[model samples]
Target: MKLSPTFLSRIPALFLSCCLLLAFGCSDSQDAVEPTLDMDSKANNKSANMMKEYWVEINPLNHSGVTGQAKLVVEGNVLTVEVWAEGLEAGMPHPQHIHGFVENKGNATCPPPSADVNGDGLIDLGEGVPFYGPVLVSLTPFPTAEDGTIHYKQTFMLGMGDMIAYQALKPLQNRVIVLHGMTVEGTYWPTLPIACGQIMPGNSMGMGNR
Candidate 1:
């Protein structure tokens, strides 16, 4: 059947209306999806900001000639520690530790030669404690320097006490890393501080600015 001219003329307008409706529907769907994508991006940025890294440059303390570097990474409640050193007492066990002052009592620091209160010519653990504070984390079974060198790495999950100690380390500038043990001939020699370093903030790998 042949359609009337009036009806045929209205058909084009009907088709245009349908096209406009479809276009608007697609735009609304896209608008709804955009916010979800934006939310995901924000979440990712927040996560990246939560992670931090720090470093220390261990230097000889008792003229032992020991030197090393240490890296500390904190992600959530987990911590990773890495230390590399040379010029230690060969084949001897070195007790390494992170030392800090609790509750901001005082600034953590490496003991100077003047710390030898007894005038013993070497800084023992007791003498060094005043400068570096008490041990917060012990990096032990202790690493034995096979050839006057040590390479160590370990990860730890912070417990209540550990987390408290860790919290005190915020703005970690003064926290110290102490490596003990040298070839000196004395009963306290093994506990004597051979090298020390202060922790400082470090650049996060590929995580800065999210």
Candidate 2:
């Protein structure tokens, strides 16, 4: 059947209405999807600015009741260290270092007491140096407002040795930490390890800003 002229003239308005409805629906769908995309972008940006935290819980190795936390935050090439301890002798500068070995071959393993092949009744730092790399950070406890207490927090740029350790993708690789007591006259250093902790690794670092 042939449409009347009036009906044909009103067809344009109906077609316009349908077009408007389709456009609105498409716009609503896009609006819904954009938030998830935006959220993902924000998360990416946050990760870009900050790396995953590497944390270590220190426990008494020789000194009883000694407990603390060691935190490392690596942003870019710089590593920030935050270490605090309790049950320590006040006003003492307890030397702490990373004594984990990272190598592809011999002398690359950080051994336990069983490693003392000679059974000389001592585990020398020099002997472990070959196995567990050098002391990456030697911490000095700063005197707190309270008498004889210490709080150690410092930032260090990644050096050649540390950069090598950080590159190791293994969890807790090359992060055996030792907190030593002050040297005493006629006392062998092996007994000085007051507290010990192994720094467990975390997720991979993020790249720069998006």
Candidate 3:
């Protein structure tokens, strides 16, 4: 059946109405999807930045026989840890392993002492050790500063060192930083930590913003 002119005109209105409805639906769907997508993108970007702008700094409090500070900086899987000792006379390479969590700053209790690489609680040392290989940012050993201060810096690119434990640690939490009585070779230190500090904010202080 042939349609009249009036019916044909109505057809245009119906077509337009359908088109408008479809357009509105498409726009609503896009709006919904964009927020989730944007949220995911922001999360990923924040995680990337968290990895990039992480750092830790230690300041020693004494000089007689023990006292020093260590600073750690992590960026995009690369980690740089530096130690400054006031009266570091020097000795054999000491044993250095990421100690477990310490309940108190004055006590000697360490969390189940596993080999933590990232300072994280994970059992794998590969995720935490920055100097293992691709995770190293820089490693520098220097003489005592002009004022009788001992300084050592180590850098490693991402994926280089055994950082298993480091990666297991909770982000932006507190971890222990221990300085052996001697150099970090393979042997354990004396009864307690010669020097120690807490890993705060996962090197976030070094970052310019948040």
Please tell me which predicted candidate would have the highest TM-score against the true structure. Answer: 1
Give the lDDT of residue 39 in candidate 1: 26
Error of 2 at 111 (Å): 6.6
lDDT of 1 by residue, 107-183 (tens): 79999899999998988777887898766666655787788899989876543332332344445676788998776
Candidate no. 1 TM-score:
0.69
Tell me which of candidates 1 and 3 scores higher on lDDT: 1
The local distance difference test score of model 3 is: 0.36
By lDDT, the best candidate is 1
Flag regions of model 1 displaced more than 4 Å.
1-49, 160-165, 186-188, 203-210
- Candidate 2 accuracy as lDDT: 0.47
How much lDDT does each candidate structure score? 0.67, 0.47, 0.36
lDDT of 2 at 135: 45
Output the better candidate (1/3) by TM-score.
Answer: 1
- For model 3 the local lDDT of residue 82 reads 65
Better of 1 and 2 by TM-score: 1
Error of 2 at 51 (Å): 0.8
lDDT per residue as tens, model 3, 1-210? 122355336345433432343244233323322212132576645644654333434332111155554556665445666665555435323223223321121222222324344554332222222211111111222232345455666765433332322233223234445443332234322212344444555444443222
lDDT of 2 by residue, 60-144 (tens): 6432356776777776435677776777655433456655433331232433565455676434444444444444444423222
Model 2 residue 23 lDDT score: 41
